[model samples]
Target: MQTVSFLFFNIILPIFIPIIAGYLLQRKFPLNVATLTKIQFYIFIPALLFTTIYQTELNSALLRDLILANLVLFVLLWAVCLICARLMKLDAGKRSAFINSVCFYNSGNYCIPLIQLMYHTPFAFSIQIIVMLIQQLLTNTVGVMNTSSANRSWKGALLENFRMPMTYAVLIALLCRWLSIDVPKPLWTSFELMAQGLVPTALITLGAQLASTHLYLRNFRVLVSNAMRLLVGPLLAAAVCWMWGISGVVAQVMVICAAAPSAVNTVLLAIEYRSDPEFASQTVFLSTLLSALTMPVVIALVQYL
Candidate 1:
């Protein structure tokens, strides 16, 4: 009971309050979700990524471990999703959405705040940032290719990734670090302020997006996708961490991030490519709602494990 209460008050409540507020605000006022998402995609998210990557002192070994853990888990989850889709006899459109729903997760808006609330340390937050970076990179490239119908080329997908400011933010931060260049105090202050606002703005934007989404939960495919995302995801993460001999906060963060709901961007991609947008949106909504129950349990287990 104490553990349950702790998880509720500390982990779940703090994170969801802002999300719920955003949802309500959007419902009442009808927010321009596109503009809100643009603010995040163009400004806030990049600033957060830049500051986190620039400030964190990740050693070579730890960096390697972080990269490998994310890549291995991604590949494993992708394979599992494909097998499941095949068994279900889903068509190409449904298969693509199924795979994306299971593999890509909400590492930004949902996860960044959650980790910040739970750990309150740069180290843990930095781990989440790395995970976010890898996720964005993959989601843009592989996810784009997967979603695109014929006549859409891999080159276009790569270009789309290059167009993302998040990619450049990471690159510039790394360059600054390698060159031992200091961000001028004046510039650094602006960056810091943006970074600080990222969590709330992101969560609120997510809420607004959720407010506009339409969900139909009767589909068996939606349930399967959520199960893979909410249940199988963390289990796979834990196994990967164990295989890699990762423990402590790194492993904990890995598990929590793995359990994050489906990424909202998947819905956008689905809409763009006409690859079963309904399924994509449904998975995103249901998985996020269900994660409210599953995430705390995952966090509690990871804390003790």
Candidate 2:
């Protein structure tokens, strides 16, 4: 009871109320969700990614293990989504949107903050940062490619993915990290300032997207997508953790992170690529709003183990 209450008041509510505000803001005002999304993708997200990667003191061996773990999870989610899409007989755009809802999660704004609040240590937080970076890279590249391909050719989709400023930002950050290049203090501070605002920016965009969603929210498809994102996602991560022999804190962290909601970026990608943005918005809103209830259960289960 204490855990639930604390998590609700301190962790979940504080993190999620911004989304509600954003949602209300959209309903009241004439905000340009597309422009906000563009600013996020082009300016804020790239800054966050670069700053996160550059700041965290990542360990090579742990990073390698996390890469393998994340890779396996992504592949498994991909296969599961593909089979489910086939079974559902969804059209190309909806199929792509469905795949994204389950496969890509809210690792940056949602998941990272959860980890930070749970484990009172920089080490655990840093590990999650590494995972978040890997997830961000995949979400920006393969995720974009997958969503865009519903409308265009694979070649065009690939080109589109590479063209995103995020791809270049990630590459540049990585290269700088490899060469041990030290960014000037002023420039690094500027990056940090931009990156720090990503959480609210993303949540607000989610709310704005939710404002624009015109789909029937009380349907089998919406329920299933939410179920797959909030429940099946972490279950698959647990299975993969067992398969990979992950245990202790790392296993717990992975499970919790996997349990996060559908990425807000999914909606952005859907809107930008002319995919099923309505469905994506519905999935993201439901999953994020309901994660408040589900995440506590997941945390308790992790503790029990």
Candidate 3:
């Protein structure tokens, strides 16, 4: 009981306060979520990723394990979504949206801050950055291809990933690390400042997005997607951690990250590709709302397991 309370008050409450503010603020003034999203994608997120990766002491073993753990979990989620889609007899667009809603999670804005709050170590933060990168890569490449194949070339979807600022952020960080290229003090300071604002800005953006999202509580399909994202995800992640011998903070971060809600980007892609945007948005909103109840439990469980 104490553990659960601590998780809620210390961790969960801090995260949601800004989210609720964003939701209410948006409800009143109606901020442009797209502009906020671009700020996150172009400026804040890359800054956070670059600075964290450059500063963290990443080892080959840790990197390899993080990559492998994410991949295994991702593949498992993908397969499960595919089977579910088939069983549900969804059409092409809905199937694509369903797969994306189930497979891709909100690793960036959500999990990064959550990890930061849970563990104050650079190691845990680095693990989450890598996880976020893997998720973004897969979401942009495979997810885009899946959703846009009917109207665009897969090559275009593949190319779209390269255009993202995050792609370059990882490359530049790794390159600087490899070459021992030290960034100028002023530039680095700027990067740190931007990175520091990521948590509040991101949560606020998410809240605003939710405020604008049209909820569909009665949709059985949305519930199915929510079940996969919020419930099955942590279970699969726990299994994957056990399989990989991931223990301690690594295991905890991975499982908690797995329990995060669906990606907001999934809805953007669904809308862009003329897929089932309604379902995509509904899943994101519902899953995020449900995760408020589910995440503290998952956080506590990971601590014990």
TM-score versus the correct structure, for each prediction: 0.95, 0.81, 0.95
Clashes of 1: 0
TM value for model 2: 0.81
The Cα local distance difference test for each model comes to: 0.89, 0.79, 0.90
What is the per-residue lDDT of model 3 for residues 200-285, given as tens digits with 9 covering 90 to 100?
A: 99999989999988887899999999999999999999999999988988888888889999999899999998899999999999
How far residue 246's Cα lies from its native spot in candidate 3, in Å, is 1.8
lDDT, residue 229, candidate 1 = 97
- Number of backbone collisions per candidate, in order? 0, 0, 0
Ranking by lDDT: 3, 1, 2
Task: Give the root-mean-square deviation of each candidate in angstroms.
Answer: 1.6, 3.4, 1.6
Clashing pairs in 3: none
| Candidate 2 worst ten-residue window by lDDT | 149-158
Error in Å for residue 215 of model 2: 6.4
Model 3 spans > 4 angstroms off:
none
- The residue-level lDDT of candidate 2 at 5 comes to 69
Candidate 1 residues 1-305, lDDT tens each? 33866897878888888888999999999999888888888888889888888987788899899899999999999999989999999999899989999899999899999998888777788899889878988887899888874746777767877888988998899899999999999999999898888889888888888888888878999999999999999999999999999999999999999999999989988988889998998999889889889988898899754
lDDT score at residue 176, model 3, on the 0-100 scale: 97
Q: Give the TM-score of candidate 3.
A: 0.95
lDDT of 2 at 238: 88
